[model samples]
Target: MSSSPSSTPWSTPCGTPPLAGGPGGADALRPLVATVLDALHDGAAARGGPLPPGGPEAVTAHVRDALADVLPDTGTGAEEALHALVTALAYGAADPAHPHCAAHLHTPPLALAVAADLAASALNPSLDSWDQAPAASALEQLVTRALATEIHPTGPAPDALVTTGGTESNHLALLLAREHHGPTLQTVCGANAHHSIRRAAWLLGLPEPVTVPAPDGTIDLTALAAVLTDLRGPLLVTATAGTTDTGSIDPLSEIADLCDTHGSAFHVDAAYGGPLLFSATRRHLLTGLDRAHTVTLDLHKLGWQPVAAGLLAVPDTTMLDALAHTAPYLNPDDDTRAGLPDLLGRSPRTSRRPDILKVAVTFRALGRTGLGHLVDRVCDTAQQLADLVDKNPHLDLYERPTLTTVLFRPTDATDEAVAATRRDLLTHGHAVLGRAHADGHLWFKATLLNPHTTPTDLDTLIALVEGSTTR
Candidate 1:
């Protein structure tokens, strides 16, 4: 059970006056901060696992009741009111760290990364201009340079930027691709390429993307080559490193060779599979990542970090110059001429959060090898779940687990039956497994992130799924 009304730790006084010349210092926020922390502790320690039953309606009601009077009043001692809101927000939402919560790319954040996030939030440095965030500007450069080394260690380090996620990263890459070529251009991509790529083209006002055949969740090189040959104008070939529906990596080397033959700029969307570069045995899967003109990587997906941690890298820094502008106030010619560093030319956002801080903290805490182990753990769990699917007479493995995603559904059940199973799981506080449709069929997608989940725990999940069939 969640924290009770009588057990609420909101006795701390509220509406404290601000300190002289200091604004709301630690003393002013002490009461509310302490109460909020206590609320978090209680919420995490709730009796049943992280998620509560009843789904969206339950959580929405929790919030509505907690703040129903917010529209009318602001004079009340806010301790109880704020406490109720935060507490509801905590226990009402689904917890990704739970052993049975295998739904999406969401991962349980590391303790150190969370701490770093809190610190960065408090600082609230904008990474756009150097004066706005002096240390952040320099530090972002250093970290991005270091990250560039990881992708292409042997070659010249690509320039990097902290982006919103794979969407923005892919958008920026395609934007550059469009800029490199004139209005007359074609974009060659797999049918399974992320929707963001097509949206990026639309945003760029380019013609519709030319998609290649990908029946088996990966690009067919022959079809890709045929598309490349048939294309006449400047070509932008984008390949998938890890497809969304099925985690299948395209033959990067073969694709890279075709791009070379076509003289097209190659971009790789490695948002899901980029972390596999850390795995010693699996790194071979992305052998030609270095050859791509640009790459998109999302840390929140597999980097064990919070959301909004994404990166875009270009092997040559000049590629990003397309997005550049001479803003005299932000990056003046005088400042550029001087020794001062300017980070304003990198990304689209003007005042962006320095999420790279938390990413850096995570990297420092868990070295490359440690990060690789985390990836391996999740991938191994995926393999285990796939094995479970293979052994079960009812289930069918969509394909092998290239990363940490498993797609399967009951062989004896209908599409409605499969979807109903997922809905029942959430309604009864079982597990929040993902449900998706691909190849005109429904599938249950288990995206593993928590290493603490045991095989027995998965067996219970399987049993629950089996039980849902009768419903």
Candidate 2:
């Protein structure tokens, strides 16, 4: 058209226009990303202290000040902004490596796994399609198979998917159970089962789950049989591998036999105790896991992986078809059965990250035997702490630990005094412990996941609680 479109200023006039900083814009971002990675690595290594107690207002003010100072007025420089944001966030947070960080089901991530996480972030692979993440998709499949092998060595490999966490995995198991067994499907769970199982029933549009009372914090088989008699149609029974408060294990073998007799689908929520599969000493506790129709496990809690690494495993690969759906654009007819199961078809999430890299890297770094040793060490340390409690005249053992958790209370203190002492310990930031109610009394608790924790450290914690009882 007229005179070569009038030569707009935005368009390049001649000869490639300086090549956007001599090799395209990627060169400009390389150094910035490297700087950010260095800062993050160093910050994590320093063993930072806990947060200052100003809460939301202080955090918001810091954010506002940083944005005003670092961000450009006209347009945001994303890389720079991200670096500044991360630097500010790393100022104060709970150090998982700290021996006393024993409150929840959290664990210090393995060093190799952390490195793998960094690699995954840089690659930014999505598991939705092979084109997006070819190697990662294969790695996920391999890790799932490895985990299935641990549970059922003789059975065929089954289908599994990575979920957000234990909550989502439990939800998936409920959904699958409901789909297989219709609208009238009822569930039976022990009184000591994790609360998430009940929540899963509600989310899946099932009636309120039938609760089997566990008088001694272990599933009462007689009560379970009575509940099974009352339920109609297909039944779903959940057996707990490890409970929250007392770390009690349900009688899985007996529950499996009952489900078999009633023709019900048996599911196991082994999210907290699944790692015991690797420990020869404790593996017998989960004796009948292979018989369950489905099982849930959280790698973050006991596998020493980072957060959001949960899995839902089914006995047969075909069971996953219950959740399959075909999206026209997302997974077209062209890519249906090319050895790709389209992880989204089996899981609730679509745009899932390649979480399996950490698992694969961890396995390669520490072989199966090494992982088992680590788990056994943690349990041994827990027993050591329990022994301390037994030997001390001031502390009373609440229950014998079947796993790595120790629940106890002060021998001479009242319930109110125990509560006050726990509060005092939390306020001072000396150590973090847990609390629970059993038999109408509140007890102090600790979940020992850190293998480096010693009996002396627990003794000091007991002393701290005793000292604070009157304060």
Candidate 3:
């Protein structure tokens, strides 16, 4: 490798220029960040109305036409160039802050967290070692302890590290489990468990994951017991804290019992519903979470932080030793475990971004009470939407709301009609909803995470649905 200071930049790969002041200098970034933030605000407001109709080609053509000058042939001044690029990209996307954006488990990031993201990016700190980021590593350690205390209070104080998102978090859990259980590992989970578990199993050089059927969107204990009886090798069983489609929670206490009986590693995938730990009324749903050997939570989902803030936490710090690897230059022995975790050891990523800054900022800004209130509000909103659908003459409610997702469909509408109504809703931009096939019927889905949404907004959404179907 070249030994020159300018030859190899920090964090990023060699030859790629750094973002700080490569050509445009430091003063250029202030205006750029401001302009990008403003454009995002405006774009979100416009997207709250209705969507226009088009296929990929039309969208591509329109975007290409509008952004012809925005993308550079040669780089313009950094501030102007950066602003134009983000603004063009923000034009017609779903605004998670919108009242009608109840399609997925995604939430609007807390304001302080979002601002912290900008600052972190501007500073470009790396978490691989303390030499690169001293205070940043300390903040990550504090936040990890806070999350561990919240999730596994009575158990040994857990160790955690941030990853890209829920998918990566799930992957890390399984990876650690495999290291602890050996390559002959057999994993078990409900059919409704997040798809990432299966993918993670494949990535870890294991056979396909054995799935237990969940007819009511929960793991069948008898079926799991049968599987345990026949299996002989090391095992990892995943119990879902909250599922993706219907927001259903698996029976964690029962699953923990089975894991104990069989001497298997128990992991809980709580990426979508883990924040319920903050809600007094909903905490019972995750009663046995402390018994889990490993747990995954996504700050971006219910934690109200930006994307790429998922966490994988283990009940005992020793379990994380499975992923430990040493590099002489990177983590010297005396320096390695000096009251700070080398996030690279606990996570699949190396040279990781400073994702902890946002989480730390969010925790400090929102505190526990504010976060609990937001969770309560979103759950209440989901229930309200479910009640609305149940009361409507033309609509049928499919699954009850557990955390923040409600699945329903029009009672009188056919599959084709439901599909058309969904397409029309998207094309006309009246509201954005999700659709999924369940029990031989297509169900219209809504995930309520925006607390500002009201009953009136839901009423108007139903009215629009009714109008679209009739038309």
Which candidate number would show the highest lDDT if scored against the true structure?
1
Task: Kindly indicate the candidate among 1 and 2 with the higher TM-score.
Answer: 1
On residues 1-471, what C-alpha lDDT tens digit does candidate 1 reach at each position? 333323333332333333312343444445556777887766656526647787788767877886777656444345666677777777776788887888877888887887788667766788778887888787788898788777866655467878989999998888888788886668888988999999998988988999999888889999998888888989989998887777789999999999999899899999999989888878888999999988999998888788889999877666778887767888898988897776677787888988999999998888988988988888898899899989999888788888888899989678888888898898777888897677788999888889788899889888888888776
Sort every candidate by lDDT, greatest first. 1, 3, 2
Candidate 2 or 3, higher lDDT?
3
Per-residue lDDT, model 2, residue 328, is 62
Q: Using alpha carbons, what is the TM-score of model 1?
A: 0.92
True lDDT of residue 127, candidate 1 = 77
Q: Could you tell me how far off, in angstroms, the CA of residue 311 lies in candidate 3 after the best superposition?
A: 0.6
Residues 259-342 of candidate 2: C-alpha lDDT, one tens digit per residue: 999888999989888888987777988999989888888988878988778998876678888877777656666676655446
- Backbone clashes, candidate 2: 0
Error of 2 at 13 (Å): 28
132 Cα displacement, candidate 1 (Å): 1.6
What TM-score, to 2 decimals, does candidate 3 have?
A: 0.90
Screening candidate 1 with a backbone cut-off below 3 angstroms (N, C-alpha, C), the clashing residue pairs are none
What's model 2's TM-score? 0.86
lDDT of each: 0.81, 0.76, 0.79
